[model samples]
Target: EMVMPGDNITMEVELIAPIAMEQGLRFAIREGGRTVGAGVVASIIA
Candidate 1:
């Protein structure tokens, strides 16, 4: 995928994991075979 310097980008995600109270789940986003963004899900309950 080719993205311009000022292009607008949107992404969707689906997380399916066994999360406990206050548990942190780590995630990362890759672009051009490299990690560009990363974050942690502080708490998620289902």
Candidate 2:
């Protein structure tokens, strides 16, 4: 996905199974050698 500079972005994921069983996920938003932002998958159970 393309995002404009200085814009806020949000992401979500739904899992059928328990998040504990999963190794989790990783994300990286970068521009060349610089990393603009990053995040990790958090367990949010319903």
Candidate 2: Cα lDDT at 5? 72
lDDT tens digits, residues 1-46, model 2?
9876776666775645654533366766578989887766555444
TM-score of each: 0.39, 0.32
Expressed as tens digits, the lDDT of each residue in 1-46 for candidate 1 is: 7665556555445546653434466676688999876656655544
- Cα deviation at 36, candidate 1, in Å, is 0.3
Cα error, candidate 2, residue 36 (Å): 0.6
Model 2 quality (TM-score)? 0.32
For each candidate in the order shown, give its overall lDDT on alpha carbons.
0.59, 0.64
Any runs in candidate 1 off by more than 4 Å, and if so which?
1-23, 43-46
